[model samples]
Every structure is written in C-alpha cells, then in structure tokens.
Target: MEVLSHFVRVSISEYFRNLPVPDSFVGFARLTGTEWLTLLPFVGTVSLLIYVTIQAFKAKPVPEDTKVNRKIQKESSKVVNMVDIEDLGDKVSYCRCWRSKKFPLCDGSHTKHNEETGDNVGPLVLKRKGAA
Candidate 1:
C-alpha cells in the first residue's frame, strides 16, 4: 500500500507539472523574468478547454423532492370518489409504494419489488356503489 501510494503521489505531481500555467505565474513568487509573458494566450486556451470539458461531463442538478412530487402528481392518474349517494360506476386504484408500472393499480409488480427491497406492500382496490 505504501508503494502504491507513493506511485500515485508521483504520478499526480508529474501530471500537474505538465498542466499549462499562466505566463505571469511562471516565475518564482518573489522575482521573475517577463519573457514568458508571450505564452499567456496558450495558458488561457488550455484553461478554457479544461473548464468546458469539466462542465460538459457534470450531471445536471436534481429537482427538489417537493417539486418532483408536484410534477408527478400533475402527470399521474387521479382517482376521486363520491360519498352519501349511490352511483353506477366509479373506480379507484391504489399505488403500493408508488412502484406500480400500472400507476395507481396493481400489476403484480410488487412481487418483484418485495424480492428486491424486502418491502411488504400491497395494493388497495376500491369500488363505488354508484356511477357519476
């Protein structure tokens, strides 16, 4: 492990040493020659390329849970029931743990879910006495 760590440190130092440095910073912090100033353009180009590459590969930020929930509710199927009166037709589907492939309904998907997550969840079925 010590040898591996030493090799990593040496490799990182060599890699950083090869990275472009601004011409103004090439000399010692105390005293320096200005002849390297001509390399400023190359330094800027290298820095810009690095910045763009990093940004391109970065994952997009995720939305907050509340915002995500609101969006999901907007897109999800709705089930409403009427009370105190007889109706001919009404239906309600329950989404067990919101993991249903048939949203708000049971499609035996929970069996697979139980195996994977060790969760004991089941769907609820609702029926209305009358229709709207």
Candidate 2:
C-alpha cells in the first residue's frame, strides 16, 4: 500500500511537471476597449436569459379557477384558516368541491355538484388514530 501510494504521488508530480506552460495568461486586463465593448452585449443577453430562466422555475403555479363569484368571495380569499385539532372531533370531512356552505368543512354539497356536472368529486375525509 505504501509503495503504491508513493508511485501514484511521483507519477502525478511528473505528469504536471511535463505539461507545457503558456508564456502569457489571457485575461480581461489584456483585452482592448473594442473587445470589451463587443463582449458587453453578449454578456448582458446571457445574464438576462439566466435571470428569466431562474424566475420561471421559482414562480408558483396559479390555479385556473382563481376568480371566485361574489357569493363565495370571502371564503375564496388568500388567507389561510387555522383549525384547532383539539376543538375538532375524531373524524372530519373536508370539502373538495367549492360549493360547500361550511367553506372548508364538507356539507354534502359535492353530491349536488356531482349530479349537476356528472363529476365524481368527493370530500377529503380525515380520521384520527384509533377512532372508529
């Protein structure tokens, strides 16, 4: 193991030493005013494209039915309702269809919606541990 390690280290050092080195390094400092000006538009375009791509990926998706009717305007607001688990019973049925009179809670309104639209949308039923 020691011999193999020494051989590898020697081989790497020899390989690097045999590599050709440039007499002068090309950098921004070596560029003329004309060259810098020519590169500015290309750099700006690439930067703009990168920024737009990042923003597109970071953006959250908006739902198609975001515009609610005046009747359920308050219920369809951006504000989140915080429900206390202690206040709730063992089992709860949350509304999947927007026609619920109780807003978040299911009041069998999806049945009427299903009958009207011929859709099979139902409630999001939640059950607590060991609650029959």
Candidate 3:
C-alpha cells in the first residue's frame, strides 16, 4: 500500500517557526531516548579527561642545579693532562726521561722512575684513576 511506506513530513515553518530557539535550553534537548542514554555517561567522562590534560600541560618542570656526578665528570676531564708527541717530538719528553713502549701514549713509567712520595705520575697512570 502507498500509505504504509509514506512518511509523515512536518513542515519547518509550522513545526519550528513559533519555537523560542536561542533563548531557551529546551531547543538543545532535541535528542531521542536512545541517543541521550548512549551519550550521557561519555559526556561527563570526556569533560573530566580534557580538564586533567589541560592541567598537566600547564605544570612546570622541577629545576636541578646541584648535580654532583655531572660536575665531577666535567672537572675530571680537565685534570688528566696528557699531550701528543706527533705535534711536538718523542713521547719521552712528556714523561720527562721516563720510557714507555707504547710510544705516543704514556705507559706510566714515570710513576716508577720518580719516588711515589711526590705527585709525579705519568699521563697513562692518571687516566687509569678515572679520566674523562
């Protein structure tokens, strides 16, 4: 039957022409029972999640200036005091008459050449005691 398939169409002028739209909250309540039920829980949950994310972005990071390990690493690098002979001359010059089989790099023969009582350690020995 043609009447069974036909839908009842309401005109926009007659159905909504007299409604107070902009000044009333009832205009926003145009949802069906099923649509309202489905979105009710999700609306509040999403609002709270957005609020938490905004708060996290506004937080400041903690400043740390007294980092001991970083300071020690920086200072220890300057204290090694090793030199290259290729730019100068024989490696024996750095150790000051101390012999090293490794040539350019000192093998700590200066530690044994001079008395241990003094602070006269070769470059290689100083590096072994934690160099940069």
Model number with the top lDDT: 2
List runs of model 1 lying over 4 Å from the truth. 1-33, 65-132
Better of 1 and 3 by TM-score: 1
Ranking by lDDT: 2, 1, 3
lDDT (tens digit, per residue) of candidate 3 on 2-22: 554343344434434433333
Q: Model 2, residue 101: displacement in angstroms?
A: 1.3
Which is the winner by lDDT between candidate 1 and candidate 3? 1
lDDT on C-alpha atoms for all candidate structures: 0.60, 0.74, 0.49
On residues 2-116, what C-alpha lDDT tens digit does candidate 1 reach at each position?
9989878997677567544545853435342442353455567889999999999999888464231232356537644343425323765465655666664567767776797
Q: What TM-score, computed on C-alpha atoms, does each candidate reach?
A: 0.31, 0.43, 0.22
TM-score of 1: 0.31
For candidate 2, the per-residue lDDT at 61 reads: 87
- Report the poorest 10 consecutive residues by lDDT, candidate 1: 63-72
Steric clash pairs (candidate 3): none
The backbone clash count of each candidate, in order, is 6, 0, 0
Model 3 spans > 4 angstroms off: 1-28, 59-132
Tell me the lDDT of candidate 3.
0.49
